[model samples]
Target: MMTSSIVQRVSECFIKPLHPIEDSKQISYLTGWDIAMSSMHYIQKGLLFKKPTTSPNNQQDFIESLLKKLKYSLSHALFHFYPLSGRLVTHKTQHPPSYTIFVDCSNNNPGARFIYATADVTISDILSPVDVPPIVESFFDLNKAINHDGHTMPLLSIQVTELVDGVFIGCSLNHCIGDGTSFWNFFNIWSEIFQSQSCENENDVPISRLPFHYRWFLQGYGPPISLPFKHHEEFISRYESPNFRDRFFHFTPESIVKLKAKANKEFNTTKISSFQALSAHVWRCVTRARGLTNDQKTSCKLAINNRLRLEPPLPQEYFGNTVDVVSAEMTVDELLQNNLGWAAWKVNVAVVNHDDKQVRKMLKEWLESPVVYQLGRHFDPQSITVSSSPRFNMYGNEFGMGKAMAVLSGYANKFDGNVSSYQGYEHGSIDLALTLTPNAMRALELDEQFVNIVV
Candidate 1:
């Protein structure tokens, strides 16, 4: 078992852009969907890299070198994703009541929070084969800057922690600024710069993909709707309670393939992908562990990337929130009484229903009635929200050291019935980070079907 007292913060400061934004007067307006997401908490993600053995013998010098390279690369990367260095602002006195907000891409707001820290832990402390590590949360900054008071918080914040045998990069980003896809895009680009160790010239950098900041692509068919503050309060209160426990489960390639084969055989259909099959399996196990009534309604919510689902396809580098939740609901008995293929089919259907027309309709509806419709809002003890994509090149994020030892979600422990998946370091395997009530987690641990598949 890993110890709790592991990480310690050495310094914290705001990292401004290395170069000033030339167009200080330019503003990027938030679409109705962005405005609806402004009140949500920042997404906290961490990548842990094992210490490189090639570093000089001196410990302090090695630490300094790592920080310098990281900061330099991050500042240079901000030039391409400029809006991330900006702040969210509102014009409350405007005629339409200014419920809408925009990103101020001015030179004055050209900074992101950076933190330096150390940990008395090792890669083995986190990557235990049979036990979940307690130090997972300690490897990240707990005090993330959520946009609670409008423009009070920065759009992005980063924390770098040095461990006994590894380094951890913790990133906290405002949800209104971008979704997971955009965040990973920025991460991959930053990694490219760090690995290359030269950010001097934009032309020679070889960073081919540039972010598309034009928010007009999300424009819907109707005028923006105004939601009451009470509704926001109610929505936030539902999922923010401090009554959850987070754990990670590993599924090897063999197990995943076996599950997929089983699911396909039961349905006599070969359409279910690995993700759909795994999600269905997890949803069933979680529902069974919760021990809800047979008639209780439970939903599996998945965030679908709308960038490609849109009619004309948004730019691959579009740097803003462009995702919508697609869910499939079934009663507790209906889920438990069925086979894995039954649930997998439902999950597959949910994803297939989110075509171009459905995405457009979702945007139009949100524009017409602007209310916070996050997957979190649909979550309860009986429901699960699955975020993160297994397709992201998380293991490839080599920032001058080497490949990351592990990737973790810093905030998954805070909410119940939440599941995030990442591509495991091992080929064809997946890492599932799950949060649930203490009792429910215990029940899940004792579940034979679930335990058989998990490594």
Candidate 2:
């Protein structure tokens, strides 16, 4: 076993402060995705290798050698950023960008078992999956499997099944680190590094001198983005509750297209996208399912990427939190009666137009504002909330074996949290995964339309 001191020393080598920029506004923008950025500093993608039955005794040596290789490779990555951090900080005071791989041979399944490892991949590649397992026969009870500790990196368990000589690996990762795309890219790069190593005994890890420049995002930008007080208050209120449910709902691609087509035809609107239509439909379905009246209030929060919304696109390699949560709230009556087109229009109005300088300014001021600016006094936590991060077309992720079979998002460990995602299937169908409170799903189960295909 590795000593704690050894782990601590390795971690320190990776955590270093950057050269302070002249402008805080730019710093904020650069760090807008700072939470995500900070989390990246603590990234750990573990690969579990199955030890051969005959070679079980060599596992310890393998681990030691592997650790040396990983430490060197990751330490090299940290070194490239040293100049940017003024080299004042050494690895001792900082977090390192290394992950761990454990070799488990304790299981008694001698020849029946296999091997597997997990790593990062590109942002685009991680989100989209080319294959998906058959829908579980009874998904209602699947809730027991989802767990979210809300730690910087939440661990998810995957059910492993045997495939060929090696056992297929089951995996789950926290979304806060990077979207599906970023996750895959990191994995692919790691795989490239791993596959080329002849043995874990290499004295030096190779360094990838990729670009790390980010000054372009702040060329002519000034600061102090102000966001609507009502919007800020609304989010705070909804999220304030100590308890929340995050449920996952799955829908086929054909169902989504059909829903969108119907919305388009019914509303006589051309600009509304599938997301707006589906979100609107879900909002309507759940509202009516819960028996909420038309006059009651509900809202939907869409997580928008701010990378390209600025005057110029943020760097593709810019590793940070570049997401903005945009909310669309309306009286239940308006949401229910409005044609699909109009409902979608509401989302576009709140999210797409985020490029406006005023909006950016307001957002800055709001985020920077202290807790005293919160508007929680006006609302309750029980109000309805919805969010979606689709994974159908995320860029460039491919494990050496092939594309992932499926991807799911917003899984929660609690009883009241609801999270949603749009998954792509090999059959050309889109799947919807909604995570909601058991009661909420139970309510949904009563609907014949929803019940027939829930699993």
Candidate 3:
């Protein structure tokens, strides 16, 4: 939806690591986890910042200075997150006619991208809307770019858009390279390095967490896991459903506590986490707003982190995707008739039960017959995928000038029943971006039960 008429692209360049890895260490293999996200579109999201008022210079000077700081800090970030600078390439063999997908991190590989642009929009335009403005998608150019396009496209791209009175630092990262965890890790590091620019000693800001590059693989599986699908089109869903709408809703800390307490009290246990309780509430409210009958079926595909679910737990700093999509299913009556605790318990059981053994079993099964997460393939009108967690540090990213004003995502990989949660601008607050049918959106906006707690 972005065009040159609306957002002007001033300049663009590829950014590489300041200290490159040797060509041998550059070719990072696609782990089973990474491969699972290979065909998925680049994750599109970014932070919004108020324009710096301290700058005494004109707009041109401010733009140049800001770009310099961003490029410098990003270079340091790339030194550690070098995979972001590499490209994904495919190898075709003649004898067997098989193809292999890998990251081309050789010296000849093209680096990541940094684009500087000026927009005629404002922060209010993005933040004040009940529904995110469609023009916000223009903040980044990777609107429809999938990870497979990494062969030709930059695996990672950062687009800095200078708005009338604000700035938007948008990033488009190939999903195959990492998940939301990895993306934020890289982003926070970049901000840290950026903030340290004004310090007396740049070395004072040491890299707090070094990422673990080892990809996850089943113990018995080959290093090169053979995927069941041959071509990208096999599982990619091209049919875009019309009449869908997206809405932004927020839940404050007090509301979160209340939701969790109510859930635990009803269950007569303290096992239900705040996230589970909140998710269950959202699922119930969304289902009811859809005007579905009591007998209609519904499902919630909740994505869980597997960093600590392995036999030998992965480090907190482990990079790449270890997401496990746990599916919770029930009839409309079961979900709506029951209390919030009942629905939450259903989700909690699925999550607490996915321990080491369960994760290993899922990994082994995937290795045996790999199934790539098809683009918009998980179809069920009543099913919603709740992804991106409140645990992700979304609001604390500070770069000296000030903290982020808000968080916004671009139009990529979004479909009906897709929900993404982000930490709000304040602590203990969560913002949910829900995509639903246009009619459902209208109902949800008017649904008193759903609107009462929304901040």
Candidate 4:
């Protein structure tokens, strides 16, 4: 059952760029990375901030002013990340019933949707529970929105929920626009602008870095190739997540160091990374929790950043998706029979071998005869794909308020097997969030092998 309390909407409006390009209309074609992600869920993340003052009087007035300051800063931020303000435009073809996708910045009024809402809860009301409270889901603006919804919906949406003692700034951006790197780029600038306004040296704060707008594609392949499928319906299916729950497991720095040391002890070569060690551990624990047979097949899907893998590497600030996922698979008998280093080595090989040559080959195959991805399309029960990176700077996004108390996500694109990882507030720590079936969740909570290392 859903929570009884719900957020009440106060007002809504769209915030356009403060400085728009004049005379010329801008258009950008969606790259292969963008096209594939365009069919997935919007990336939803939120920052929790404690109120600045302790006064109990005129609280609503304070919140009103804070909202005004945020929107103003957002408008300025949109000037640089203008593609996010533009909506996704599609061209329809009746003969074969297909559509071509692109972002159009020519609209008279293009902007991100800003929403304000209030909830009767406190910060403790959220962080006190072992599992994420359902009310936390209400803070996000785009509840069930997917990237394909960009055709008619706002490319970016912000929902600020006023709580009794704090504020939750939830954001939703189309995955097609960019990945985590791009998201943080815009957010960091927004905070810098906001903080400068409160200081006497307002003009002293300058944007640390500007984002590059070029999209990624294969070397020989041209841009914006059409999908072999006739309609988007064939590529996407309805998502039903009525029976899943989200849980966050915090892994401390000490545990990670131990895990890494244990993994490296095997194979006699200390090459396995911390990520590989932890991923392998999680894969083994989950496989056991699910109670599969010894012969059952299991697979793990992990995304490798291709920015550095290309012949001519892309800029660090390149503001588009340069991500591609690879699978590390094995049977349950082999996986469980092996030691920590063996499984970690398997993951390492998959990541290390996905070089420029291999990536180009895969890209060529997709372009020539597009593979209709079905088995792993919708939370394939046999596979697990880690969504976000632990390297992203999540704790540094301080928007005039103090550092974030915690980082949370909204209810978008969440299925039984989807996973998202975040950098913890403490150095060398990681926070892992997962959406799993009720049975699996209970089993995981009781599994001593996994719980011994978690904080």
Candidate 5:
């Protein structure tokens, strides 16, 4: 529902990269995990900030200075995360004839795209309520923000929107290159360089952890599996449901505590964590809202970060995708009829089952018969995909201006049954942003359990 009228002319658009890579044509093969994500849409992250109280004597000078710093620091950050300043290349001439993909990290390739534009909106326009603001989509250029063509779409695209009293920094990165952790790692480093005002001496900055880019670690004990293009096509078709809408729901600390206690009392068990309790409550409410048959099976799919769960933990900075999906399913009647604690227990069990051995087994199985997109087959109107983590310091990302007033998901085209979570602007609170079919969303808004917990 956003229109182009919201965004003014583009002030600038160009490619930014670190110092030229020595080899202009080096190729890096993607892991099975990366190939699986390649078919999905780009991951969009946005940070909004209020206008600085103190500025240069002139307005134009202030804007120019800010842009210069952003571009410079971003280029320097690319030095540490080099694969981002490249493109995804699909090989059509493999011996066995499969769509093999790899990262073309050559210096000659177009680096990350940087765009500057002006917007005729304010921070309040987008973040006034807990619900997702309509203008959120208008804050960035979606058409060019994510390159659909693997050959030409820059691996990363950054769009900065200058507003009357705020700024919106939007980043779109190919999911195949890295997951949310990798994206935020690059973002935090960029902010560090910008805040330090030391683009020239970026090397002098001490990095607590450096990214590990050798993806061979993900390979398991088996011949490489062939990932076919047809799989992605089928994956897309499965979730192409109609009348979906995106909305955000806020849960204050007090509500979360109360929900946890209530869930525990339901089954007389005290082990459910906040995440489990909350996810269970939401899953139950959503299923009820969808009006599924009692005998139908409903599932909740959670993306578990395997960084720490691996037997020998991956390097803190292993920069590629290290997430594995863990799902819990129950008949619609059981999910609806059970107490909150029963649902939470099911969720907890699903997570606990994903131990190191299970993680390795899953990876090995993926290697034997690789399917890039894993969620579509089990995904339906009765399913939910939960991503992002409240533990990530989304609000701490600060450029020279100040900390972000709000963090947003740039990829709002999320289908129904998709949920993303983040730390709330207010401490001790959690924000749950979800996309659901229009009727389901409307029913959820009126549901007593949801209304009681939502702020």
Candidate 6:
């Protein structure tokens, strides 16, 4: 657990107007999509630090110093310093969507933060493990601590666990503020500041002065662009009641290599990669495991950053949401009948030239639809939030400790099979974290063909 003094001190350094975006600005033609893409909220990556020797006695003080330096470093990173214009839809009482941070000082490790908390901060965990699997132990503990409901932090938590080796630092952030690429950009800067290799200055923050035009976009685009209600109950439920879920899975390197090799052969395209194949394959696995038939239609919403694809790629420092979703739809039959390669092919079709006019219009309509408009506002962190995009993996996000072994959303807030894939894992295969209903998981296992292959 961390101390209030340290939290307070760090808060004092970071909680101020580190970056501000005026509500009146209008985003440029392509940039408007950037803000819209970023509007989709998710959790930032989970970070693990080797327990420092000085931590045992003055644990809290050490944490405070680290946080103060972290905040100062973030203030210098271009991504953290940009402005936001996605706040037009927020309720008056809600805090503006710049960078909001929350903290949890609980006695027990909760393991995940997207759901409601059932415990409190009376004392630290007595049953804490002495030898945790270095990264995994700190990862789970931090989730348990920071995801607690009463507290919300812009920078998730700087958790101190009772490890045999030493104290480990766990840091998290909310994705609504920045993507993994942007987060790493800030982290690299933060590391330099920590080492005193770079000096902090107000000008170090990026200029997020891009024009924002929600009103104009809504006015210029009509009908589907204005979220429509197909049914009152489903439409209203998004606001009346919201649901979210998340879950994680572990895979050895061998499993991923087999899947990738199979995908490559099946697709008849050596260029077809694991992310494309596995994401499609898993979507098929889970959707099928959930008993969705081929006749039914489902959409695979993938995030595509418009930063470089736009007429003029957004300024490297232009930090508001600059992503858009490229979705692919298939009948359950088509998905069920196809091999991983077929699925990969379909995914390739959906993602290639993803920003094409028809595809963009379709995506715009879905986001503007009444169900999404209402539900997105009341989205529950505990409910499943799916982000299968590999942009985070493609972006160079190494801090001093080295690139993250795996990264999950700090804001996903649920255990319902919210899935993510990361680069540089144990070996040839990819590693993924997924949240799935217990029943669905069991069903997959009970089905001999699917179960025997992966396990």
**RMSD list, candidates in order:** 3.0, 12.4, 2.4, 2.4, 3.0, 9.7
Among all windows of 10 consecutive residues in model 1, the one with the lowest summed lDDT is: 222-231
Q: Sort by lDDT, best first: what order? A: 3, 4, 1, 5, 6, 2
Per-model CA lDDT versus the true structure:
0.77, 0.39, 0.82, 0.80, 0.76, 0.42
Which pairs of residues collide in model 3? none
lDDT of residue 297 for candidate 1: 94
TM-score of each: 0.90, 0.55, 0.94, 0.94, 0.90, 0.60
Best by lDDT: 3
Where does candidate 3 stray beyond 4 Å? 1-5, 54-57, 93-97, 198-205, 228-230, 235-241
Pairwise TM-score winner, candidates 1 and 3: 3
Point out where model 1 deviates above 4 Å: 1-6, 54-57, 94-96, 129-135, 142-145, 148-150, 198-204, 216-239, 373-377
| Tens digits of per-residue lDDT for model 3, 140-174 | 86778777788888989999999888889999999
Candidate 5 has its poorest 10 consecutive residues by lDDT at 230-239
Q: How many Å off is the CA of 193 in candidate 3?
A: 1.2
Off by over 4 Å in 5: 1-4, 22-25, 54-57, 129-131, 141-148, 198-204, 216-242, 374-378
- What candidate 6 gets wrong by more than 4 Å, as runs, is 1-42, 58-61, 78-80, 84-181, 195-246, 251-257, 312-318, 353-408, 411-417, 427-429, 445-455
Q: Residue by residue across 1-455, what tens digits does model 4's lDDT show?
A: 22667799999999998776443547777777777776567888999988877567667678877898888888877877888888888777777765567888654645899999988888998988889998988998877777878888998999999888889999998988888777877777887778767522323345778878867777665566566566778676545566887999999999998888998998566899998888888888877777878888887778778888877778868887878788789998888889888888898899999998887887777667654333235457755777677898888887756899999998877776677888887988999898878888899889998999898
Candidate 1, 1-455: lDDT as tens digits:
35545577899877766677777435777766566565466777889887767545666787887787788888878877888788877544334443546778888874787889887777776676443465665555534334443377778888898878888898887777888888889899888888876544444365857888776444433223343333234434223547577778989999999999999999999999988999999999999899999999999989788888877888878887788889999899999999999999999999998999998787777665666644355457689989888887788788877777778776522467889888988988999988888899999999999999998
Give residue 292's lDDT in candidate 6 (0 to 100): 68
Better of 2 and 6 by lDDT: 6
User: Compared with the true structure, what per-residue lDDT tens digits does model 2 show for residues 1-455?
Assistant: 11111101111122221122233211212222322222121111222222233364564454445444443433333233222211111011113321111111111111111112322222223223322211221111112221112121122222222221222223333332233344434444434454445444444445342424332223233222222233222222222323323334566666767767877777676767777777766655665566667778777666566657776566545433455557778887887677666676777577767784744674455345422212233222223334334542421223233344444332122213233454454444444554444466567658765555333
lDDT of 6 by residue, 114-211 (tens): 21111212112312322112233223223432211212333233332323432223345434345545554444444554454333344443332322
Least well predicted 10-residue stretch by lDDT in candidate 4? 370-379
Indicate whether candidate 3 or candidate 6 has the larger lDDT: 3
